[model samples]
Target: MPSKKDKGKAKATDAPPKEITQKDLEKLAKDVDKIASKVQHRQEKALAKGEPIKEKKIDPAKEAEMRKKIEAMVQALSNMEQTGAIKASGRKDMGDHKFWNTQPVLQHGEDVTEEGPIDPAVPRDQVQQEPYPLPKEFEWCEVDIQDDKQIIELYQLLTMNYVEDDDAQFRFDYSAPFLKWALQPPGWRKSWHVGVRVSSNKKLVAFISGIPAAVRSHKTLHHLTEINYLCVHKKLRSKRLAPVLIKEITRRSHLEGVFQAAYTGGIVLPTPIATCRYYHRSLNPKKLVECNFSRVPRNSTISAMVKKFKVAEQPSTPGLREMKPEDATQVRELLNKYLSKFDVAPVFETDDDVRHWLAPTPEVVWSYVVEDTKTHKITDFFSFYTLPSSVIGNDKHKSLNAAYMFYYAIDIPEKEAADSYDTARYTKQRLTELMRDALVLAKQADFDVFNALNLMDNSMFIDDLKFGPGDGYLNYYLYNWKCRDIKPHKVGLVML
Candidate 1:
């Protein structure tokens, strides 16, 4: 993910040109004349001061050539604007994606029929042995996440300077325990937890990390390093450290023979294989409205809004229980079977990987399963993790407790399936029941809201569960790989 404070820059020029109006040409001419007059006046002042200003006289043909060149430059800039190089959102187009343009990602509007890496793999020995050079006074270091003090330092840095809502009303507050749980997953590498610190005071200013995963796209499965949590201090954004952090992490991953990476960001970069929207369900409508995280309807009263979103204290699922260590193996089999139906998904090779990601962790992750009472088989499961956001300047609430929906699965017997339509209906019915129970559990836990992306089969229950569409959109990117654009329903992998 790109840093919220320090996004990289780039350039592009393949767009077609738009016609330039005569009035526009006249305005460009006048602007050039004004610049020439300003320069002449500066030269005259230098001569009066005995600075011996050197002057060059332009012949008529040379002057015409200069004017023509200036017009061409103006036309190119105008073309850029017409092609959305300068967007209404104030984001630059693919041509201006300075950092991503140099990487192995696809450019905007590029089509793909065959999926493969944009760059071929290099031998491990050919990978960079030394870390990329940092700006003067800033040195690269591997963050020791196991140490409590170092983890606290990382926590503080992210809490104060990480991703925030556009209105600045809230900022992500990833807890210390959550950081450790996310960064130290299965196949984690200590060396991939890259950080930069100030040499003078030893203050950590920037960080980027990667964790190994096996991801399947279409018929091919690839081992990839999932990159995330990229952040830079607000004051150091001008130093262009975000790009450096990205390059350094990529180098480290390459040294381990991983050639492709996956990530998600709120902002658009060179290109995205899938774009997903966030949907939120209010658990505590009054708190959300008071904190400006949401608003009460203009026609509805606070009491009405609160009553509308209220959930039952108990879950509806009969055999639902918190997941235990023994449940990991069954959950992994169920999840992998369900995920295989998607176009892109993760490959959990062992029960350990499932336990690390889906098993319950107090105050960090909560997973539950529905077991068949007679057969004692795990038939369904769902999970959500805590990711609270600090409610900026809100006196009533200090933080908005949020539960983000994670991996989930439901068993559908192949022998009972008559056709695709019946299978779709069965899946929808099972997921809706499971998710409703999940929402009740979240409400009982005192979460202010429950959030989920419009990915996988979430579209089946989002509206039925009263989850309103969010303003944010997350774009999923694959580094060094090109794949056909996927719809939200076809995306099974979720990034932290």
Candidate 2:
């Protein structure tokens, strides 16, 4: 019998497993049926679209024997995975990853000494010609976010079925504007916004999206895709639709000549090129405590805890102000120069890209810049974006407003000299000063908390500024590419 767990094929649960029951077997049967329907649908879609469908001869006796063997193996594997003996990333062995092992990604426990694509790029003509087939009752649709109805459908689907915590006490609430900003960045392709919908009712049940990115790994630029927003309705997760969604998106990226990709997840998968810890600074401790998102320390009073985390009333930087459209060019230069120091970072090409990313959007993103009062040069800049988590089952609050630290840069003049130690100490002090003001700004905006990853120069201030380490760990993975592992300190790219 398979062990019962609530994790998706591509997701993991931090909770203890529940005992398997008859209901679990029935659900498993439906999942198997869904997959079978998709296999049948592939042939039909191939004939309809005039694409080749590689067929294998059916042998009834052999098929039945094979099916029994496969079922036994799957059941055993499921039990192992549910027990944490195996992992979503196939930690036990390469063979555990029936799907990932065949893909061009780094294998678990494989040491990476080189940095480059695992496979060379192929011509567009050799890429997949049609979307991956879905179950007969389901069809593929490419979302056009400009359409309000379509946006609303996506919003509704994710609002109900997206990322959730182990306790089911919180869910990510990505606003329509945030989705628009996240999905519709410069050079975004409509084709990459893949959706799986019920053919009978045209209701969306699954979705995965990819956006173009020129990510640099080990200072070598790779034109790749940043894959995100993978979701399947809770009712259909057992259908194993996530693998199909991933394959479809990868195929779509292939058609665009992008052979490499990047993604982040809470679950530990086949391999992580880099792992980062989540750190949080609570602004509204009372709200966090009320929502069970935080607990009062062993020997601290609520009033004392609140006072301990109090931020300054105003920003202390000399010329820090809201970033403007005109400052985009200067900020881009500063970012590019600063990010080059990292092993992995995004290359901000133009002022437009800077404006799109770093410019402030009311309630969506807050950006600030400090000017050199004498030179009028943009000396430093920092930004954070808003993402509110729904406080599930909380009687007092509906949402927990969070501000996530985004890209930032500090001016450490190379010519105006100091030793490495002194430079590092100075940089830390400058960033701490800047981050303190950022805390004040975020608090003023009524954010319940501010969160950041242990990446870039963030480590320099997290301790001095009193940010607490969070239990959540995020693993960063690169798809179809091989690269030496990046330490959290060298990760300069911030994915939304």
Candidate 3:
């Protein structure tokens, strides 16, 4: 009763499903069995090799129940994947990532304890006591740097022992000009300078120095004393005398009504919170190549690019000059702009931070600025300040000669948006040029060495200058601190 087309359709429908022979089913089963056997063998070998088995030590009934539960989960996942209801991989949520990364897994029967929140304001218990007893022969005497002879001896000792190690940019040579500037009278406090001496011999052996922190926007209500230039003579390093010097300095700080102290050093020595991150930039392509500072390139493009860039000098179009009071507003803008690119930068709120950092005691702080004279706009700036050494003994008046570099910036023109990388390259190039200028200034000023930290991206810039990696690194430890909503700039000093 059907038409010809209907009969054809029915014939197509009548075709039986293609038959899978028993041999095919058997082959599939064998393949699966082989795979399962291989997995079991691997697991067994691992166990024999002392790898812990995943099996939990539970009652037999409980073990069986757990296996069933796991099997159920596996089956549910398989079904969901097969039905295209869920992804087979890359299904991680934020919570899953956090849990995987941060959450600790507890072992069975392990005790669970919670750590109370940390209080930064409360100082932790001292771990190690002062290594050596205070020398009875040495009288705890503070030296009046006002005395020209004492000041000259102090400078001589610092220049001899604490002089710039090979990697310093600005050399701290103990010059007569510097002593005169440092010891210039009335307001300079003797309490800031302390020394230890053997009552028998009037040799100045150990020394410490502190300076008031007065940078605006970065100022602390409590006077902060920076402890720096701590060195024991090479022969005396083993005497465990560094701690005594540190304790003595602490006593002085407390006497001065100072509760907090900060210093940067190479070793993660005294305090853990003081450990700072180091950033480096490469200046000399040949040096970078020799030192293995350059990263291995994934391809030739990067390698060729670096080689080409290295051969060329960064363009220096802007003129540089000493920073003036009028340049504060522009300096602040530039600082804020450059610093915002980083996670941490010096906190500068008011113009005072700029003044203090740039002009701190005209004799101690030196600042330089690069400008577009035609436009009367400042384009870049950098500053450095002197940090004195800690006091040890009166006879061994050893001063640690050092200077800190701070607040550098560069601005790229709007027209050069496409060539900003070139602008940055030029900016870095300018640092080298300016450093040479700083060196000349430092030599005249009689500093042993100009010390600056390679924080964040500045590390990259520092390497370009051929500066030796300093043993000293600055660190940050926060106290009674709440996380501020604002993110800091990446390039400048992070600590206030």
| Cα lDDT computed for each candidate against the true fold | 0.80, 0.79, 0.46
Between the candidate structures 1 and 3, which one is better when assessed by TM-score? 1
Q: Write the per-residue lDDT of candidate 2 for residues 444-474, one digit (tens) a residue.
A: 9999898898789886688768887564556
lDDT of candidate 3? 0.46
Model 1 misplacement above 4 A: 1-92
Candidate 1, 216-325: lDDT as tens digits:
98877989999988999888876778889999999999999999999988666778787666778999999888988777889999999888998887998989999997
lDDT (tens digit, per residue) of candidate 3 on 1-496 = 0000001011122222325332343355346434543554465556558786564322423433443343223322322232233333423121222221221222212232532112222232332323235677665556667687888767766655553322232223435445544433223356667676667987877676665442111222323455555655544556756667766665555555554554543322212222332222223333333322234446655456345433223333357677887778889888777665554344455576566556435556678777887888887777766654332332333443445565666676665445854455455555566665655555456554455544534533444444443222333322112112111113244331
Q: Estimate each model's TM-score.
A: 0.83, 0.82, 0.47
lDDT (0-100) at residue 75 of candidate 3?
27
lDDT of 2: 0.79
Ranked candidates, highest lDDT first: 1, 2, 3
Clashing pairs in 1: 9-98, 10-96, 10-97, 10-98, 11-95, 12-95
